[model samples]
Target: MPNVIEALQPTLEGAAMRAVFALPQPLRRLIAGPPIRIDDQELALDAQLLLKLQKLTGQTGLSAETAAKARAGMARATKITAGSPVPGVVVAERSIPTDDGDLPARLYRPREVTETGPLLVFYHGGGWVIGDLDSHDDLCRFLAKHAGIRVLSVDYRLAPEYPFPAALDDALAAYHYAVDNAADLGSSSDAIAVGGDSAGGNLAAAVALRTTRAGEQKPVFQLLLYPAVDATRRRRSRELFGNGFLLTDHDMTWFMEQYSPQESTLADPRLSVLLADDHSDLPTAYVVTCGFDPLRDEGEAYAKALSDAGVPVVARRFPDLIHGFANIRPVGHRFEEALFEIVGTVRAALELHKG
Candidate 1:
């Protein structure tokens, strides 16, 4: 990882001062002792959670070497506590058809649809090996309420059981299902958008590309937040931000080890969207990144490549945020701002799709 000094540079003197300054006191000590974030006392709670997990699993402790498969299984369930429900939005459990079987899905819709809006198919982030619909429940609700659109959250099967193509297959299946069943789901917009964080973002991009190739309708927009788009693990971000960050090199390597194809699928562009031959026909996109995140550079590179390919791209780098920050709005105020930004982007994309 970049030395502590370099990584903290952007936020050291400015907006990120809080998260940065706390590093020495709360962050640094936590590495060898215990994690404590001055900005949020709850971080101490996370350290405790790690300690508990470590003890239960019979592992040494919560360190960079924790096994990802165990982590995924341990994180099987994610609960989202609502601050308050948006007046018109309702979150309901549902099913989406896929080639393998009927996959689980959650549908979120604004309370009222005065007119047609946009349909968003969202995937959750958990490095492909972890995460689920429940894990990202808050994000879906916030998007539906704030963006004023119908959001279909897909619960694609994870890796080591389903593996790489399995999640990718489910993602495409869910998108097509949303397209075909939009009316039944009370979706007003004909144009569909797909989004997700981390691994989910990878699936979203893959679905878009696959849809285009299959002659299926493309999503009107793509929203990728700190997406793990490259499976090859050759990027500078992979090397530079490999350690100390919330997401460490070992954790990523473990995730990749669990989710990757058995043989030579690593080179497949579908697996690594960054290596795709062309980004030309893809939908307009909003790529979000956390300044301290290891995946930051590749995401920025993808945005630039998309722009270069003639696709309209909007990139937002939150210097004060960390990876997976969007999943914890209750923990940090920045989460709320990020939610609003996502809503704005979705609304604008829907409007453009209409025109």
Candidate 2:
């Protein structure tokens, strides 16, 4: 088995392009953060990769500092199609009521909007601290356009202020509101699904469990992008890939600290669905993992648990990808291929539920 660093090197092709074979780890860390060694591949730490991220940031014609600042206030990520635009599938902004206040959300509909297209509720990744709709905008638009589905990007409250059940509550509320108001949004109430990347994915899974417990129909399927399903921070993967990846043990600890008001909530099943008593009644799932991420093992573990409990679960590990590669769709061929594969998976999953 290779180390985490080895697993992540390839994903840095553009950055490491034409580089020497034996550069020191520290230099790489300064340039690209850390990589987790798993089997033969290496995974880059998400934050560092994004910070050192070159092409997408440049192509978007936005400075990293400026883009990061704008992201602080937004909710869901998004992008629009060009050339022969769809008549009605404009990316629009709106808010849904939560117990505390209005939770911001983005709606993406394609042209020829069916009075009831399947809807996907999306959450952005930021370790519960940094991301917003602006960060993930491109991916959501791609999914909506490619899958012929409606995508609602949720901007739930972040940590250090809202914390824990606050975000969870917001996610649940947004979901129900979307379902109840599906017609107004021009989507089928019965076709709603929930999903997110990293922390958002964890929230989506928890929402699915809570919704089922409350006797609501589970979302059609969960589309989890390398979700952080366990908060314990004790898994071997955590220890192994903990330091070098863009998400280090320190960073995750920071995120957990910010997101959980009480330290004990780290063990709460709502925060760590992998610790839940049963995953049997949850919706079908498509869980994606990165070979080099610290959360890789736990994501796979949750998928296995779901499968073992008789829930239909499909898992994919992108051996050559890093944690936030899903957000960098326009950068590399690998991202484009992965993006299409993701949409195809959702399309297939939704079709099954429809039948």
Which prediction has the highest lDDT against the true structure?
A: 2
* Candidate 2 residue-wise lDDT, 266-301, digit = tens: 889988998989888789999999876788899999
The global Cα lDDT (0 to 1) of model 1 is 0.72
TM-score of each: 0.78, 0.79
Task: Give lDDT tens digits, candidate 1, residues 61-136.
Answer: 1122434545543342122122344467778899987669898999888877645567889999877777777667
lDDT of 1 at 119: 82
lDDT minimum window of 10 residues, candidate 2 = 75-84
Error of 1 at 94 (Å): 1.1
What are the root-mean-square deviations of the candidates from the true structure over C-alphas? 9.6, 9.1
Model 2 bad stretches (over 4 Å): 1-37, 42-89
Per-model C-alpha lDDT, please?
0.72, 0.74
